[model samples]
Target: MLKGFLHHYYAFGLKVTSDWALPCSQRVQPTFATLEFRKQQAAFFAARVPRALRSQDPARIHYHDLEDGSRYLKWRGVFEFLISPDSQVVFGHSLDGAPAAAFRSYMLGHVFSYALLGFGIETFHATCVVVDGEAIAFLGDSARGKSTLAAAFLADGAELVTDDFLVLGREGKGYIAYPGLPRIKLYRSMSKHLLPARKGQRFTPGRVPKYLYPMEPVTKPQPLRAFYSLVSPDAIKSQTEVRIEALAPRQAYLEITENTFNVRVQTRERLESQFRWATEVVTRVPVKRLSYPRTLKVLPEVIAAVRADLQASR
Candidate 1:
């Protein structure tokens, strides 16, 4: 008999069969949905076609549509996930190491975001923090300091709402945001600079050099207060201090759509639904461009600038 590990994350109960325990999630009854792991199969998927959604990392992903109407994803050396149209059961296996090797694989990409996307859920590559009883999100490209800025806010007494994968849903007049796993991934340099005393376990020790620090996460969902696109003008040789500029609804809508996770694989119906949701979200929530000098020394000033802006808005 497979005894499932009960976990509560993103407002759902999960009975995960893998050794994937997020320190921040609450232990609950094993009555919820289950994600089982099995041995990896080499002949599980069909041939790789000449054309598919290709990222810079060629082996990052290879998606296929089988003759039997099944969808398969070969995610590099991580794992292959097979999901049915109903989006209920997900079967996964690690490409290397033991069955538990899929633990980090699922944590990195497979489990929540991909599974939710299968169900047509709208998720973004962003981190969120609760301020004044409302949620504020920071979205940006990789290594653009989304997590760095989030760490700054976490140091300054703001509670973390989510990290990396932000889940959004329609709730009455506005949208409600759910918290991801209660953790933040930070680089060694930033962790030492911002949180010198805080010890974090290494996430991708030699390869990524990032550490995962467990956070005291907010339990309930909160209405989104604002969303910001964190950018650094210093990359283009422009000297600018911390600044927050309100983005026009049109621009904000575009940014929101672009930052959506796994957008390439979305069906036409899912894309249309996301368009409607993003349109409504931008109209009500304040979307701004948060530009600041790209330097570690000014992070405190950047955090203060954001705090002042949020206060003045209220």
Candidate 2:
């Protein structure tokens, strides 16, 4: 199901494939083929991707069309690339075999979103809710309630910028944050908790083998003041207070490097450059580890503390 409003992304053209089989909208949105390949495109993806990933995931067809002279698909990761009549490029995998197109698109999106941020803009996997003009990002692993936390901030009057990713760059000695890409992904369980339970809805779009989700209707991002890592409590007594600690460059590098979208596909030189950017980001921003109780009850307190921390630093 197309969850939110019928929004358009003026920044970039899109080809979407929905599991619910939603019909296309305008010239920009078409759920049909162009003039060439029909199911052959799917075979291309199937032939190129690995058997294991394919078995684990059979591409579900959504959207396929010609745009900007490139045939694009929003597909179910069922088939490997045989000869996707659109591209005729022949998509294939290495020994380890790449993930399906759906998974790879997101990872690729993140890398480019950050790299293309322009003039020091960097993307962070976090939920950014803008409070009083500054963006406070809630970073966490899947099921960590990043969006739930952002929603809490919104209820408390914070504006939503990006639910899953944030772009950070320097405006002066201070930094400026920008929103990159649209769409927020949610798990069925998580979606139920955050967006209200819908009958007969069993899974989210990026469910099963994937953990990342994208959110849209985001506000323009502002400068990043801090970075937080969401982790579970270390001890029973450590429940109430979130363990917000400053992060060193080495630690930030480790976290961002590992979690970056398709960090492995990046060349060695690119990896080093990203690493340097990570360090510069850590040094530029007040990076911290926000170890809080897993429940949503303490969300407000956490946001308040973050707000106060920024105020004090200022």
Candidate 3:
């Protein structure tokens, strides 16, 4: 641990201590931290070469696995994160004078998700929310409106559990979804439509920027109830009505596996274990296909349909 003054935070069921300010709940003197983030000298990373490169894009973002069990992630011309073998400590170095917000954007996202995988947590690329005391997750590909629907849920009085990265742990016969960072990323048009009163900070700069809006987070884990795999209406011609269809166990397992985070790093043994784990999950939790038109006007209707589905299942 690089010692000076460290900030303690709690997220995804882990107590974290970091040299930088994390956008999570702060805890004073946390007992037995589960993870630590420290700043390391650039020369430290410069001296080491990657043993196995995992990512396809070397110029943008690359994932490297070292022979010593440590992993390095580099965002070209921005920042890099080195995660310890035990996944307990993360050392970061900024490159090209990147701003603090940029560093944090990658840290809370890619870095944190990678660490969760190392810790043996089942991580998924999904946005989750709390509804009637149970956790509901929305899973889909990019531009499928998972975040937009989640933002709509938030406006309809649902609590944000996590956005983009969800970690699950076994609890009793079911799984519990842990709380993630207390922010949601939305496109500018969606931000204006759903959160008109709230001012959003642009985390990624581009011609079309995604804005991050901070919301009150659900600190405690909630029982995982259902998984909704969103289907774009454009894929189904003339499909105007929102539809929810229950998936069979085999299909559910496949869907979950497809949405799992950090699949490239998994060994054969790990992959087999994950397959079994996902099978067990689908046997307990329900997975459904949620299809609807990609439009803001029908958001309320979509939310009502989901609530009805959940209620009917219960």
Candidate 4:
């Protein structure tokens, strides 16, 4: 249980109050915030969680669905999060003597996505940027250059909307993409090429180290204009050209389904709901396949192709 004073921050279109300092834009305390993060002992929260409903990743993470619609998520050697049914409050505890940075990483990444799911918000495993008053999303699997592409756009003065977790909310006839944490992760080599002057903090320090490059985040939500599903040049036989191809509605729906964030919380009802939501999104918005050579030298051309395609659509 959290006592005393709390810090308030804004991200993912929600006002969050936390007992710890979060890597988000600070905001004035609202009368009623949308989410609260509380620090608690492991045993305190564990006693409240139900038995393990299932384990999403046996070696990495375990998930438990509480009786009152809340969720309990445990990441091996990292942290445990007990989220309220309404997704309004989160109780967290570090596990296996994990560092504070590691705990914060999981909280902002997977645990945050879980709360968004509980809030009935549609999300994707993509990075987004604001271009010409509209939001463009790049959807792909890990290491498929989504962040690298977004970094390229940011270098060209495009404002970053979100990275890794793209949150969407229905607004009138269209959808709005909300801002996430104001950072993008990129490889050291890519960072040197794209943002040479900016020194970023090491996110994953290993053989292939990734740096978290900070950027000016889009403060307001932007209207979602299009989604580009990134495909590697190697994926296509004998392909070396940068091209944009429109996806049929069915294909678009499947792409969105596959790129949804946090598949562990996807129950039968949630899947059905997602199917319907994805159907609507595909019918209304354009989803295209963007294939380009995986090299830093080709990024500008890739950006130009994307801009031309967006303009052509409009």
- Compared with the true structure, what per-residue lDDT tens digits does model 2 show for residues 1-314? 32442322221122332222221222342111221112233455454444444453345532222223332323343322222333322232221333444443443353234223322234556766677777766776556667666656665677666656554555677666655444344454454555453232222343353233333433433666666666644443456776577777788766665544333335465566777777766667766777677666677678788778778778
The lDDT for every candidate, in the order shown, is: 0.68, 0.49, 0.84, 0.84
Please give the RMSD of candidate 3 to the true structure. Answer: 2.7
At residue 70, what lDDT does model 3 achieve?
91
Candidate 4 regions exceeding 4 Å error are 27-33, 50-58
Model 1: how large is the Cα RMSD against the reference?
4.5
Residues 156-219 of candidate 3: C-alpha lDDT, one tens digit per residue: 8899989988888888999888888889999889988898887888887889988889888787
- Count of backbone clashes, every candidate in sequence: 0, 28, 0, 0
**Among all candidates shown, the one with the greatest TM-score:** 4
Q: What is the TM-score of each candidate against the true structure?
A: 0.82, 0.58, 0.92, 0.93
For model 1, the run of ten residues with the poorest summed lDDT: 47-56
State model 2's lDDT: 0.49
2 versus 4: better lDDT goes to: 4
Displacement of the residue 275 alpha carbon in candidate 3, Å: 1.1
Residue 274, model 1, lDDT: 83
Which has the higher lDDT value, candidate number 2 or candidate number 3?
3
